[model samples]
Target: MRRVTVQYFDGCPNWKVLDERLRDLAGEHDLAIDHRRVETPEEAERVGFRGSPTLLIDDVDPFATGDEPVGLACRVYLTDDGPQGSPTVEQLRAVLA
Candidate 1:
C-alpha cells in the first residue's frame, strides 16, 4: 500500500482539488490518504511543507523539485494542460501507479 499525505493550510482551496483526485484514485492504487493541516510557520518549517496542497508520498514529495521554499502559500503544478491548481487525474495515476 502507498501512503499519501496531503499537507495544506486552510486558506488555500487547491487542496480540495487534489483531495478529489486522490479519492478517485485511492481504491485502485491501494493508497492510504492522510490529511495534515499545517497551521503555523513553525509547524510548516518543521514538516518541510513546501506549500499548501503539497503531496507527500511515502514521506517523499515526488512532485517537488527541491527548489520550492517552505511556506504557507498556494502551490501550482506544471501540468501537461498547463499550470494548474492541482495535478490532473492522469498525472496522479502516473504517480500512484
Candidate 2:
C-alpha cells in the first residue's frame, strides 16, 4: 500500500481541509492515509517538513522543491486560481492519481 502523510502545525487552519480531501482521495485509490503533526522547528527539520499542511507521498514531498524553506509555517499551493493555503480537490486528485 502507498503511504500518504500530511504534516502540519497546530496554527494552520487548512490542515482539516487537506485531511478531508486526502481522505476522499485515499478512498478513491483504496489507500490508507497517515497524518503527522509537527509542533516545533526542531521536529520540522528532523522530518524535512516544509510547512503546515505539507503532503508527503511515500515520504516524498510532491509539491516541494529542494530550496523550499522548512519549518512550522503556513504552506502555499499553486492552484489554478492562484496560490492558496490548501490545494483544490482537482489538484489533490491529480496528485493522488
Candidate 3:
C-alpha cells in the first residue's frame, strides 16, 4: 500500500483545501492518507517539512526541491495556471496518478 501523508502546521488555511481534495482522491483511489501536524521547527526539519500542506508519498516529498528553506510557513505550488497557495485538483491528480 502507498503511504500518503499530508503535513501541515496549525492555522494554515490551505491545508483544509488540500485535505478535502485528498479525501476525494482517496475515495476514488481507495488509498489511505495520513494527516501529520508539524508543530515545531525542529520537528519540521527532522521530518523534512518544507512548508504547510506538504504532501509526502511514501515519506518522500514529491513536490519539494533540494533548496527550499524549511519552517512553519505557507507553501506555494507551481502549476500551469500559476503559483497558487494550494495545488489544483488536476495537478494533484497527476501526482497521485
Per-model TM-score, in order, reads 0.95, 0.91, 0.90
**Residue-wise lDDT of candidate 1 within 1-97, one digit each (tens)?**
8899999999999999999999989989988999999999999889899998999898988899989899898999999889998888998988887
Residue 70 accuracy (lDDT) in model 3:
90
What is the total number of backbone clashes in candidate 3?
0
Error of 2 at 97 (Å): 1.8
Instruction: Compute the lDDT for candidate 3.
Output: 0.85
Q: For residues 1-97, write the lDDT of model 3, one tens digit per residue.
A: 5668889999688989888988888876666888999999999889778898898888888888787789899999888898887778887788778
Rank the candidate models, highest lDDT first. Answer: 1, 2, 3
| Tens digit per residue, CA lDDT, model 2, 4-81 | 888888999888889988887776877678889998899989988888799888888888877779898898888989
Which candidate has the top score in TM-score?
1
What is the C-alpha local distance difference test score of each model?
A: 0.91, 0.85, 0.85
lDDT value, candidate 1, whole model: 0.91
